[model samples]
Target: MAKTSWHELPRGVRDAVQRELGGVAGVEMISEGLSSDVTFVAETGLGRLFVKGARLDDDLKARQLRREISINPYVTHLSPEIRLQVEEAEWLIVGFDYVEGRRADYSPLSPDIPLVLDLLGELSETPCPEIPLRDAGRLRESHARPEDLHRFSGDALAHTDLNPGNFRITSDGRAYLVDWARYSRGAPWIDATAFAMCLMTCGHTPYDAEGIMAALPVWKTLEPGDLDAVAYYQSAMRSAWQPRLDPWTNASVAAARRWFDYRVGLEVGL
Candidate 1:
């Protein structure tokens, strides 16, 4: 889908949002969106809000909307606060508390790296709520060697998609994860594991990523061979699809493969 601008939103959407927000003074299209929706920030009489909407007929997009709605409350402080959800025959929309900032720089030289790691540390401390989240293992269950799938299940709540664009760093120097579309129940290290790969995609070496993730409780306790299979299957799944979706997928591909190789070496007693 082509990028959606604020001006392109349906009048009903604009009206419903304005009614909820008291009144809308301005609408600015935020171009940093990754999903197929019209995402924008509206300056309202009450306050500024981030709003995302898509056609109700788009099944996948609609499910993603519901997923965000279902999971955001469970992962408080990790995602933007959702103010209201507007559902109608033609559209489904939700508005969030507008957060001011840019995406975190995962590159080696960037100071934002530590801030993201710090945020993850804090997030790791948030216990899982009772909501039923998708199992993380399901993503690669078919491709995974059987034993790897068992390692992926757990009680910890994870914001499974930790890609750079999915999180932003505030001007005050804090990291906030934005997309909660893939919220899942899984082993805690999987979050750190996925993030380590994200770091590698941004030019950090696998070893450098390891240093950042080394202190997490799950990472500290996981057995080497189990970690290997999980990392290998996870990365391999990403390598299969990400290349077709984004131009920079190779960096992620390399990073995930490198981690997989390291774990494989450990398994073989090398």
Candidate 2:
């Protein structure tokens, strides 16, 4: 593989992998997550494999690498194939059988919206064996404020970043959610709301409040108090970050800020 700077990788961690996994025939950096880097294909003597890399210094990234390897065995038959785990100096490397898929586009919002929602539901319902619930306190320390904790609801594995680019749509129409570094235990609605926020940010206004309502019917099942908790949690989360996200992701964050302020009746703007 050709040596490249870290920033050249879409996910920003491929340089570390190439340095450690030498003689890699081919390398394609795929997605950069909040904490980890992903490559669509990495060449090994045997064959090409999907690889993800992260620094051990990032607690979340390190934990997620371990989680992917641990949970992968149980879900291999149920979901995608997780191949192996290789530890390279200062970096955790994970390999998976390459799944053929393409990024979903934002045009024709009708089907994609519901499709992503269904994908999240399926992932959340998958049988995870004995993984600890994500520490809400730790997340609060990383991104939330004190008031955010009071709004905590039930916990489940949430794909915190669900922007359109993060989803891969196979030719068979199966949707795979990649980039697991931000995977955390949180209210299920957080993912739904985050998805909704992304859609709106991408200029797909065809789905309005009613569309968000329809996709996440779980909100209706919640008691009035529970609904309040979900709203606060989502609002606080929507406002939690101001860092430099991927170029495509910035619009989504701005839209989320607008929606959050509108809902909470606060002037907080991104």
* Candidate achieving the largest TM-score: 1
The TM-scores of all predictions, comma-separated, are 0.92, 0.69
Clashing pairs in 1: none
Worst 10 residues of 2 by lDDT: 1-10
lDDT of 2 at 111: 61
Tens digits of per-residue lDDT for model 2, 1-270: 332233454342444445545546876765544445444467865467777666677787688778767656544533467655656556677777777777766554456555666676676576435676575446655445554554444565566767666687777777777655455666555566566666667765523742664556544444444333434445555456566656655665566555554555532332
lDDT of 1 at 264: 72
Highest lDDT against the true fold, candidate: 1
Per residue, candidate 1 scores C-alpha lDDT tens digits across 2-58 of: 766766777777778778888889888866566647888888876888888878888
